[model samples]
Target: MKNLKLKAARAAKDLSQQDLAAAVGVTRQTIGMIEAGNYNPSLQLCIAICKTLGMTLDQLFWEE
Candidate 1:
């Protein structure tokens, strides 16, 4: 499924995919793939994203 929660959180923070990717030490394409549900990041990457976004794993990655 598409990660709308993650997308919303990124937008709420006023971050583009490139910005968030830089903060989390990944490429913009990686961020795009995550949002597009074409890639599943590692736990470490997931935690890095959460920390950068000021969100918990559940808030962004957990399926409803």
Candidate 2:
């Protein structure tokens, strides 16, 4: 499934894919792929992304 929550959180934080990727030490395409559900990020990467966005892993990566 698409990670629309991730996309929305990023947008609410005013971060572009490139900005988020740079903060998390990944490529912009990686961020895009995550949001598109084409990529499954490592736990380390997920934590990095959550930190950069001021979110928790559960808030950003968990599915209900």
Evaluated with lDDT, which candidate comes out highest?
A: 1
lDDT of each: 0.97, 0.95
What tens digits encode model 2's per-residue C-alpha lDDT throughout 1-64? Answer: 8999899999999999999999999999999999999999999999999989999999998999
Best-matching candidate per TM-score: 1
- lDDT by residue for model 1 over 1-64, one digit each (tens)? 8999999999999999999999999999999999999999999999999999999999999997
| Residue 15 displacement (Å), model 1 | 0.3
lDDT comparing candidate 2 with the true structure? 0.95
Error of 2 at 49 (Å): 0.2
Q: Alpha carbon lDDT of residue 41, candidate 1?
A: 97
